[model samples]
Target chain A: EPEVTQTPSHQVTQMGQEVILRCVPISNHLYFYWYRQILGQKVEFLVSFYNNEISEKSEIFDDQFSVERPDGSNFTLKIRSTKLEDSAMYFCASSRRTGSPLHFGNGTRLTVT
Target chain B: AQTVTQSQPEMSVQEAETVTLSCTYDTSESDYYLFWYKQPPSRQMILVIRQEAYKQQNATENRFSVNFQKAAKSFSLKISDSQLGDAAMYFCALSTGANSKLTFGKGITLSVRP
Candidate 1:
């Protein structure tokens, strides 16, 4: 089956540095999302995008966080400044439309020291 | 706001046996979808099964089935004839009636023994 794909399976960065996690969602999917899972914590939603604009976002998606679908095929989440708390497994998910089941990528493990 | 709870942090079952993971949620919306996902050592999130709140009949997919009590706000996953491959962390997730931004539970680690 076709699946979502993420780049840089693992990312290691220092505090204050920036990082961009990339994802290539299923070719036919229209809705995209970014979620994070702190070690030993539940996955939390970060933001959702459709039609190149953000539709919904969680409180955790603050000023330092931004998402861009710079191209037709790539969805990227950029963290302007990293903190130790920002270290987690970032997941990219996509669905055909609202109310549909999301298909997730293996995830990008971001580690900030 | 909606919250998902997985009370059992860990569970164990012998190979070829059965095990059930429990989940509960708090949501005022009458329409929603519930899902069970498995995360293994690779940390890949795999969809196990899903249930629509409006459906009255429990859903079964091969060895995986769900006991969904809509009124009680309870949804449980039962894995029958468990195999060692079933040992992984299972998460329960909920999405709004019309959206797919999933709210997930803390997760339950299942261990299948020989």
Candidate 2:
């Protein structure tokens, strides 16, 4: 089955650095999302993207975070400045339609020192 | 706000046996979706089963099935004849509607002993 693909399975960066996480959603999917899981916490929603615009975002998605569908297939999340608290596993997901079962990637583990 | 809770943090089952993972959710919306996802050591989130709140009939996929109690706000996953491969971290998640964000439970770890 087709699935979401995320690059750089593991990312390591110093505090105050900028990081961009990339994802290639399923070819036919229309809705995209970004979620994060702290080491021992529940998976939290970060943002949802549709039609090249953000549909909704959780409080965790603040001014430092931005998502862009630079092209038809690639969706990217950029963090202007990283902090130690930003360390987590970031998952990219997509769905054919609203409320459809979402397909997720293996996830990119971001580690900030 | 919608919240999903997985009461048990860990559970184990013998191979060929059956096990159930409990999940409870609180939601105000009448129409929504509930999902169970399995994440093995690789941490790849895999969809195990899904239930639509509007449908009374439970959702099943092969050996994976769900007992969805809409009125009770409970959705549990049952794994029958479990195999070693079934061992993984299972999560209960909810989405209010289309294009909405998912709220996930903390997740429960399942171990299938051989």
Candidate 3:
């Protein structure tokens, strides 16, 4: 089965440094999303993208966070300046349509020092 | 806004026994979707089952089944003949309206004793 793939299974960065988490969603999926989970916490939605634009975002997805599908295949999330609280497991997900069940990747563990 | 709640933080069941993880959500939209996701120690989140609000019959897959009460806004996952591998963190999620974003519960940790 085709599944979403994320790069840098684990990322370690220092505060004030910029970080980028990359993902390659299923080729045919049109809707993409980014979610995060703190240690032993529930998953929280970050943002959703469709039709080459952001459809919706959560309060946590503030100015420091940005997502881009630079190429047609690779989707990336960039953090302008990392903070200790930015440490978490970031998940990339995609679906064929709005109502379809999302397929998630193994997730990228981001750690800020 | 929609919120999902998993009241039981932890639960345990004997191998070959049965266990149910409770989930409740508050949503104003009549048309929405509910899902149960399992995350093992490997930390890979996998979809277990999904149910549409319009469906009256519960959704089932193999030994995994759901008890969905739309009126009560409850969706629970029932794992029958559970095995040791069934032990994991289970999350309840909701997606409403045209958005593909998912709102997830705090998650329930299930431990299966040998």
- Measured against the true structure, the TM-scores of the candidates, in listed sequence, are 0.98, 0.98, 0.99
Model 2 complex DockQ against the native: 0.86
Residue lDDT tens for model 2, B1-114: 889999999999999999999999999998899999999888889999988899999999999999999889999999999999999999999988658578999999999999
Cα deviation in Å at residue A97, candidate 1? Answer: 1.7
Error of 3 at A14 (Å): 0.6
Q: What fraction of the true Cα-Cα contacts (under 8 Å, chains A to B) does candidate 2 also have?
A: 0.96
RMSD of 1: 0.9
lDDT of 2 at B48: 93
Question: What is candidate 1's TM-score against the reference?
Answer: 0.98
Better of 1 and 3 by DockQ: 3
lDDT score at residue A46, model 3, on the 0-100 scale? 97
- What docking class should model 2 receive? high
Model 3 lDDT per residue over B1-114, tens place: 899999999999999998999999999888899999999998999999999989999999999999999999999999999999999999999988676679999999999999
Model 2: lDDT of residue B17: 97
TM-score for chain A, candidates 1 onward in order:
0.98, 0.98, 0.99
Candidate 1, residue A26: the lDDT equals: 98
Write the residue-wise lDDT of candidate 1 on B26-113 in tens digits: 9988889999999998899999998988899998889999999998999999999999999999999999944478999999999999
lDDT of 3 by residue, A25-89 (tens): 99999999999999999999999999999999999999999999998999999999999999999
Ranked candidates (lDDT, high to low): 3, 1, 2
| Regions more than 4 Å wrong, model 3 | none
